[model samples]
Target chain A: MAGPKYVLEVENVHRIYESAAGYTHAIRGVTLRVPRGEFLCIMGPSGSGKSTLMNILGGLDRPTAGVYKLEGVSTSELDDDELAELRARRLGFVFQRYNLLPRATVLRNVMMPLIYTNVPVAERELRAYKALRVVGLPEEYYDHRSNELSGGQMQRVAIARALVNDPALILADEPTGALDSATSELVMELFAKLSEQGKTIVVITHDPDTSSWGDRTVHIRDGRLFTEEEERALIEAAMRSGADINARRGHT
Target chain B: MRPGDLAQETWSALSANKGRSALTILGIVIGIGAVITMTSIIGGISNSMAGMFGANAARVLTINLHGISNFTLDDVAELAKNIPDVEYTMPKAQIQHEATYEKTKVQATIHGEVNKVFEAHGYKLLQGSGFTEEDEKRGSREIILDQYSVRNLFGNTDAAVVGKSLKIGNDEYMIIGVADKVNTFSMTQYDSQSIEGIVPITTAITRLTGNPNITSIEAMTSATSDADAVAAQTKEYLSRRYKLQDSKEEGATRTVSVESNKQLMQQVTSMTSSFQAIMVTVSGISLLVGGIGIMNMMLTNVTERIREIGLRKALGAKRFDITSQFILESICLCLTGGFIGVVLGLLGSFALCGIVGAGLAAAVTGSADPVLPVIDPGAILNAVLTCVITGLIFGWYPARRAAKLDPVESLNHQ
Candidate 1:
């Protein structure tokens, strides 16, 4: 099959952070491309610049240098308002912390992005419920406040919020970072199901265990792509070994 | 943002922080209450004074002349007959004497007048009969006691003293009747005097001090409208008759000067207005302080809700939308406070009137008690508008700061 059309194109992007000590280079001339409906993951140790690249791609921050295009629109050339509009229209984000408004109900949290959109209130609420339903949360949990929910529940709520807007790209930064091993597995399964529904999902994480959930893995070290082939091969092998073990145990 | 949405949001937020919102509103209530109470009290006093003057039918030009050395009773009668607008003139020989009625000695003033004086001047008798033309022809020594003195000396009976003889010093005079409450001209100046008695001019002069000379001349006019002009004209006439020269304007400043009640009324009005102004000013300070409190609270609220602002921006809210939400919240707060304040102020003013025993009058001038808070509706409207504008003034800067916050940085903040 031919490679899918590129939904996102990044060329020689650099990100610099200013601190009291001095300026720190987070991303160094990173170049990458993401195809439509591809489930991709970036994995590395701490300070790998994976999250930095995810931030730039999500329009949460502008890159210090170079250009990136989202759906043929150059992000580098857009003004702040235009960039915000682009993010609202095309990008959805899920953070490790969930970043849900503590005062808002789960349904209201999900409906937040739709508030900025031209969608009617009833339609926005319906779409939010549908997204939550897709993530396996009960309809009754819609009224539950964010702080009242468990770690896994909160992440699911965040996922529902991200999907409610029906954006083209989903950028999740360490989405399972706060969950336990079992809860992390549940969240990863939700991401996998979203990907199966033709979503272009990019997850950035430092955990190799979490990276195993993605269809393809790209490893980064010191702000550069270290070994894409080796990372994908390793993830594929781990999945195969798990399938073999489950089959031997007679599990479906 | 829609107004309905903003209102709902503001209400919800205020409810969430009930204590803070109540405290902020309390400031405004007290401020408005103070203004209303002060103005009402001052207005009440002025109204009472006006009522007193109105009841007496006193004109600004009506002045009582005392100690006219050369003017006789015949001269006073001649002037009344000659003057153009002068309705009636009476040579009043007023004397304070102790009278014994059933052994209770009461101090009284005997005012002497002829029959024509009572007819032209507007004097109403409450009980018994007034002196007739025959009594004037006979020069009868008969007295009229006021209702207050009658109650003090003869108890609550409405029985007439018309035939009873009352001893005054060595001479005894027959009591003709009881007069109604005398509208004393200078009672406001002297609270101790009772304004208690009246008798015919001949009786007062003959039965009391036996002084044939009249002390003062009391005159009333035919028309109330041109009473002041009549007074000025009378003063000119008196200045020529008394051979007095004008002290200031090269005309005549007569010893028998004619004055109007309008000057006294104006003085009372100005005094009341200044008092009201001072009180309103003090209340204004309170309102100013209350506005400051609102501003301080709104600022704190903005700082506390920075994360919520960031979330709103990320969700697609524009800067104006965020600013509008907060400014609306502030106005709503102040309006709530102002409403309570007006109600409390009105109640407070009523309570003050009750306490002072000066029944409620029109809060404004000219009209009677129709519109409550009798002053300008503009005063209350201006107060409400002031609060609303204050909210906008105080709430704008904080709202702008909130709208300008970077979503990424704010979200990253713990």
Candidate 2:
């Protein structure tokens, strides 16, 4: 039998953070989906719960209610180790900070995912080199430590790591958040290129310019998702009341 | 993760903080080194004592006669003949007196025994022939000097010391032989320059003390017989012969006292074992502290690498993978320390034995063999196993902490 048409399926997923103080709803019944090979972007300011939704999509977290399916497997049914296996084999995560082991070499960083998946040593290096080539990293810098690389090079190495496992979904959360405008453009172009090569890419970001590179963009506000028209009307209504949308966008 | 990859990661992680790792290893080194040193030294001493006591000594028993009790040569021979286990018997008397040869004068303990005492006591004759039965019967005024008295009286333990006349309490006696020194303990070697001579018991009683009584009768049991049982039988025989009762009072004059070398050997063995136990206990405390130090360093390593752990988790590392890596790092540290410790501990044992041997030789003014440390293979194996166990026990909590870290929270940690 063929697999599900969508690589990622989210159905009314909700995430709640419980603390000693009270229960705060981080994701209020959000639903979304991305078909195979689609470039999807989720846009929101810092407090819009996009990070929570991204965590759930990457299988780094599980929803408090509802189901999230990645590569046709429901995440809620899996234990921690099974979820880890699901992530290793099905989903790739690219974080805002790159999250490379700073002292490890570039090739070793890219091969990190394969290490968890019990890949053979010989094939690990070959796949790492292949991923690095796809991300356009030079062979000369393969042995250089990740910390010694520039921001854009580090992000590219991170992308190479994410792609090393050939995952079904590449979930990148603010991959260019630490880069300059020029490096951001290059990184977004690389993602667009990867998207066009039949890779399912879901990039979560706040900047509209970054979201413009994706085939579709969804805006999340106060733990709720909205289409472009609905977000614009909501922003227009917010501006009439003299609420600072720019200040909220700059909320870091 | 693959074992190879996990090992590589552990190695790199530890090597990243070389200084901290080295300092932590030092604690275990000192602990294991102290334990090995103490056990080896004690082991050497125990071996020496076993050599001294487990040979002819284990088959010998002594019966002391006091307060008008006496044993003639015939009586001793008759006792040996009557007892089934008795191999031989020798009677002895001791007299402490000043002896002189030419200008040399020294205080000497002169033992008066039968001719077979030399063989029974394991003293090797170094110079001349021992006294004959004829000499013993006739009270022939002949003497045999041990190495200590030979050197003191004639300036050497050479053959020339024999056939010399040595004065004892205004009576001159011919020196018939020179024997090697009797065994002495390492602890008392530095204090006593033992001067000893042997003569016939008949001569000692008639010439020196002017007393017609034997002080002690020594008996040897056959090798296959129990020395303790023979000792008890000998005591019973003596009590019947003297018509004496087993005294309950602290200082009874009419009671017979029977002592066996086997009992003495047991006492010495137990003493050494207790000392080893105490020393091991003290070293165990150090090991505890060292284990705590390892735990502290591992906890800090977990804290410092929290984000790295989270990243590995996000990359699909299982809890077992993370835990094993940290535990392996700790085991590596302790095993390295323990290896170096074993080596240094052996060297330390050798040096201590050398000093003790030299001190004994200096006090006796002669050569003494050094105690050879008995390094038990079992002990070393146990040390290594202890190191691995220490690593496992101390590394557990921190590794569990690393494994239990929430991936999302750890990733977001600043």
Candidate 3:
């Protein structure tokens, strides 16, 4: 809530997975808010419920309890198709593995969201081309299979895919997890540039270096948000453990 | 999603595994093909059989007499007068006798018939005149040699043969007519030296085999007459004519039994219908098997593409989108198979028609000609509809299962 207006607000959300083996409480209670044009990093260890929160935020899943309001609309009140429409029109997602369709070209991968819209056929390629250009992907890469690109380039295509629908909010789960530091830095810089263009971004990651690139970091521990002091302590401890990461990457 | 795009993607996914999809279609093809071939052949044969038997047998009721009965020519006349639906009656008698035409000698079965026999029965007078009513009553010595008889006795069916004389059992008679190409004549079996002829009943007994008995009487029903009604009236008339009283106290049995060809024809038709019903049921099982094959393949696809399903769902695909995609693919596969089966079945029926035609030609006239298949549009429509239903029924489960899959789990699937 540090920017001009709040784009997303969650109140005490919880998620549970039930199976024949047992019921798993993947998320307990977590409350959060993201203002428009703000870069928010959600930092957590493995099994710390950050991914569950990301999934709920991306509307890939519904929360078991509490409110998820996107742009003041109570998302929990919407049906599955409405939520899907919300995701298609208002939200975009990027995954850690750069989940580009393996056999599809870069432009086609970027144009996936447009398929759900009533946009004219002739306009889809133009929009996808503009998105790819914004992500600094060369024209040659537009026709090449997205999966065949280098880790950084593939992540770039994933970013272009997220931006193609002109979504107000982008949720990226570990956007730089598989890349070397330099490539990760480049991808993070792209996210920084998109935020400058007034796109609200939420990047989920375990790396403090990645979190530091955001405007503010929100740390999750045991399925709950840490206090400001606790977040600062965790970030400082993580920095101590992997010292001089930002300096090593020549980031200010 | 755009309908066109959805279909294109669905088709692309199905065609990706070319070999498996082809095999699934082949199963449907074989099933539909079997149904088509079976129905076509059954219809063709049934039609031909109905044409042969239904045409004559349904209208003509023949009553065979046992000699102990008192039923006579007067009874035949009484039935015509008394029974409201009895259109007419013709009494028939036949006897085998030796005949000679100059140096030629032959055995001939002589049919003693009235003038109505030529028209009532399917007897075509190929060459000469049929008997007049006066000729029948006067017991004229006019004789009608069938073409086979002319060929055997006169060596040909020449116009002069009609005027020539043939001696039957030492009684000389002039042949006044030559006739053939009738159902009765054609159905008669004759050795090379044997022949058949027809004469007026009044003359036949003395000149032919000395048979004074009419073996049977045929009754033609009015066009509007219910066959069962006519048969019952005829039977009642015969029982009364033979003096069989209903003495229940003495338990007197019937003196003569009455039979109707119409009843026998009804039994035959029922039997044919039952056979066709059984064939249709069997064809249904084949299509079911084809449907099961599609279900099996679709289930495999659902299981294999769990991750793809997740990806699609995450990409904002609603459950209906997922369901329709899979169902459309199944329909495409099954309909393709059905079309192929239809083509194969038609081709197969034509081939079978060729084989059956040759066999029939040999049986009928010893010359082969191709018999065309009688295509039943109802059966084809039934088959095509079955294909669509099979697709919908079988494809539904896997598609629903796919649609219900959790996006998070599927996206994480390897």
Candidate 4:
């Protein structure tokens, strides 16, 4: 792998949020590269702006000023329709809340992405079934409604929905944040298995343990990515300032 | 999206909020149903009224000369020639007489009339033919018998008696035909002679009256003729022509009053039109309210499904697709309501027809058999089309609002 093909790339991205409190720089001059098949984790405390960067990477939001290339296609140059097309075909997203439609059957929820895709109508259900099977959901659960499922099972169905389109990169924003440790471990094991199968995955979380599951971890704080030493120093200063550093981390 | 797929998606969306959808649809159903019911009832009433007065009766004018015993066939013909749009004119005279046919004698009416009077009065012939123009010219003694005269002579109406001679006072006359039973509410005479017999004007003037005097003259204006204006013209003409004989008292004058069916028919028409207008307005208000309800419900649908909208957009739905989905959903609801309305309207119309028909028949004919509803397929089609258009119009704003929502914002909606 002398010349690694980058599945995602972001350069000098900046995001500014304006409220009644005036402008807050959510992301400042952040540059990062995600190589193919690399399981990467972004670690940050509350208000560290990691979520903003994740949103940019997921194509759900655009940086106020920056260039983002998902699979070498510059996202900033694309319009809404094209961006939607890119999200539908080349990238997958998993949210902390398991954004499956509660009223839909598990199978129907998983097949949603296929509705927008150019895939033949007949192949959509079969693809959805395969994705559900890969997420370790039994065939019997495929017909059940999302609202009927436990928290862990819902997350699995969400993951299955993401994989149904077979995108090159999967972005997980705290995929197991709402799950118990045992279920979290099961989810991380699934991510590990996906990594073994040569799928590039980027997960955003504040848990060092969760980050450890990735091949590499990057810490972000105060609207910028920092070195490990710099991150440790920031935490020490936050502790001294009574910012509750213990609670900053998802797990102690 | 394919229409079938869109329909399937809409169905799914509606079923999720079943109560709201049903209620919204019900509003439309009630509105459309009421419109059909009113249309049917009004249609029936107009039909019955038209049946009672013969079709051309709307243009017929009755001229009665007071203190003057006679006007003649020549007088009516001269009126037709002088009046600008007057289509034709006929003469009629009536008196009571003791009619004896083949030994049976009955006091009955004897009318001096022509063939045109039969059509103007909607009198259908039951036996033999009517008197012709030649009969009037040759002063033929042919007569058309009425039901009363037929029963008096034969004890029951018999077709064989049509060719026989019947004596009225002293002269014996050959019966030419018999007429169907008719409603004679304002048909000039109500005595026993009013419907019992009809004879040529020539025969009446020469044999019955021994003079060229007619009781009244009937003038039928042409279709394009303004009955009101022509009526005024006829009245003016009659007043100008009928000279008063010098009365024994001062300030006494002879004037012929001209009465046209135009005024009576216009009154009936205007009354019914007013009723139709009021009922239509009520139905229109209900439909308008129904549309507003749809708008309210569709807006709520958009608000509640923000996350779903975002998800669909992320999944590859365009702005147009999202708009199409919401609009299709509303249209589906309205169309369902419309279908139900049409069915309910049909049932209500049938029921209304039965009730009205039974009441009319019992009051008039003493029977209870039901009459079929007056179904105008064109009206039904218009109602259906109106509902579809209503759905499209009412659903537009809400669907547009849903489409205009930012995808990023909606996806993040909790």
Q: Give the lowest summed-lDDT range of ten residues in model 1 chain B.
A: B362-371
Candidate 3: stretches off by over 4 Å:
A1-4, A18-25, A79-82, A97-166, A176-194, A206-213, A226-230, A235-252, B1-6, B54-56, B66-90, B97-215, B237-261, B356-372
DockQ for all models, in order? 0.28, 0.74, 0.50, 0.44
Q: Residue B275 lDDT in model 1?
A: 84
- Cα lDDT tens digits, model 4, B172-211, are 8898888754224422122333336788878887888787
Task: Enumerate residue pairs that collide in model 2.
Answer: none
lDDT of 2 by residue, B1-414 (tens): 888897899889988998999899887888888888888878877766655543587788988877754666777788889898988888888898987778767676787888877666666788888888899899989988777566665555564877779888989989888776443332222223446778888898889888877758888899999999999998898889877677776777777788888888788789989999999889888888989999999999999899999999999998999999999998988888789888887788777777785553343323344566778777788789989999999999999999999999889888
DockQ class, candidate 4 = acceptable
Candidate 3 clashing pairs, residues 3+ apart or interchain: none
Against the true structure, candidate 1 has what lDDT? 0.73
DockQ of predicted model 2:
0.74
Candidate 1 displacement at residue B244 in angstroms: 7.2
lDDT of 1 by residue, B245-322 (tens): 565645543456677555666677788788888888888888888888888898899888876776666555767778
**What is candidate 3's CA lDDT for residue A56?**
92
Interface RMSD of each: 2.5, 0.7, 1.4, 1.7
lDDT tens readout by residue for model 1, A1-252? 233388888889889999999998888887888888888888987887887787788876788998888877888888766777777678888888888878678988898777666677789788998999989898888898888999999999999988988888888989989989999999999899999999989999999888888888878766766456754555566587875422332221
Candidates ranked by DockQ: 2, 3, 4, 1
Candidate structures ordered by TM-score, highest first: 2, 3, 4, 1
Alpha carbon deviation, residue B233, candidate 3 (Å): 3.2
lDDT per residue (tens digit) for residues A57-78 in model 4: 9887888988989888888888
Tens digits of per-residue lDDT, candidate 3, A1-65, equal 44237899999988988999999888777888898999999998898889899999988888899
